[model samples]
Target: MKKVTVYLSENTYDVLNNLSSKRKESMSLIARKILEKGLTEEAAKDGIDAVTDAVRRAMRDILKPTEDRLAKLAAKAAVAAATAMYLNTQCIADLGKNNALELYQIARTKAVAYLREKDEEA
Candidate 1:
């Protein structure tokens, strides 16, 4: 065993000596106990840190696929919205050139028919 000396205050020495007498133990035994316990706890902390890092990396990797999928979905939605707006504007221009009332009545009839068909399917 490697022997090393550590300087302590008189009060600290008294405390350790008193504790040794109370527990019927030696100062070296107390120091060894403290060292072994600290090392074990440090080893556990290292293991926890390693697992935490691995989990963080895994979560990032798992979410990468979902992130890519969401980006694609957002792009598709943007294109669809733009197309819908263009079509609506075009239809409005066409209606202005034609009969507005006629267009509205035709749209209303088609919407009602589509809803009825959906209800029947359900």
Candidate 2:
């Protein structure tokens, strides 16, 4: 096997020294075994993390089209509701001499407030 030089902190060296004496093994052998085991565990953990990320990406990809479709449908529904509301308000509410533009703005403001109130309730 190839040789490698590594710097160890005083505490780490002391721990290794104690283990070597207790196990009757060389400090170099103990350090090597520990390093190998740590590397193996880290590699397995990294593999699991990689798989989890891939699954998350796959789920997002699968759900994206459905999300887009629902958003489009909701937008269409909102437009239809706004048009119907405007028509109903024009027929029922007294416009006096106020232009249709003013009425539209007023309706828009009311609609926004109503939506905000509903959102807060939810």
Candidate 3:
């Protein structure tokens, strides 16, 4: 067996001394047992941490493709909406000057109100 010296605070030494007296074991033996148990627990905790990190990495890898696909779908939807809006605007402009401005203003107001309502709901 290897031997190493450790210094303890007065209170800690008193506790260990009391425990040793109660257990009918030497202080060195009690300290060795405690140290061994601590080492075992620490090693087990480290193993669990490693496993948790591995699981998180695996989950992130598995979800990356789905996240990319969703982003692409969102971009496509935005483009489609923008194209539809542009086409609608062109149609309104061709409706002759007397009605086009008034119609566009009314549509803009309605769209703003709708967006505000949606925001509130969200």
Candidate 4:
């Protein structure tokens, strides 16, 4: 762990203090938790990455790319990522991990679908 000094406004400090009291957590711990949650939320809300991905896909697809390009990319990326995971048995050790992978696949599928929807509008 590392110690760093951060200055917070009076209003923000008060909110943190109140939430810390409600959660029965120390102020420092509460602050760390809040920072982590904010990062996670920001990542979830990020549209720039999605926009960039869509633009690239649109460019490639527009360039008379081979068939199944999106599906091929998704399949390769998923298999590469999954092959890196170390599991002892054939069964999943944790359902959350599997769900996360599944969620990624669904998100990719939806992104392509939405991209096509947007293109139709344009």
Clashes of each: 0, 0, 0, 0
Error of 4 at 115 (Å): 31
The digit string of per-residue lDDT tens for model 2 on 18-109 reads 99999999999999999999999999999999999999999999999999999999999989998988786676556464576667778789
Judged by TM-score relative to the true structure, which candidate is superior, 3 or 4? Answer: 3
Stretches > 4 Å off in candidate 4? 44-60, 63-122
Candidate 4 per-residue lDDT over residues 1-122, each given as its tens digit: 89979999999999999998899999999899888899898897687789889999898788655557777898999887666543322233355455655655676689678867845545
What is the C-alpha lDDT profile of model 3 across 33-70, one tens digit per residue? 99999999999999999999999999999999999999
TM-score, cand. 1 vs. native: 0.66
Leading candidate by TM-score: 3
Model 1: per-residue Cα lDDT over 1-122, one tens digit each: 88888888999889888989999999989877877899999999999999999999999999999999999999999899779756765787776655655665687689678867856546
Whole-model lDDT, model 1: 0.84
- Residue 18 accuracy (lDDT) in model 2: 100
Q: lDDT for model 4, please.
A: 0.76
Q: Say which prediction, candidate 3 or candidate 4, comes out ahead on lDDT.
A: 3
Better of 1 and 2 by TM-score: 2
Question: Which residue pairs in candidate 1 collide?
Answer: none
TM-score of each: 0.66, 0.70, 0.77, 0.41
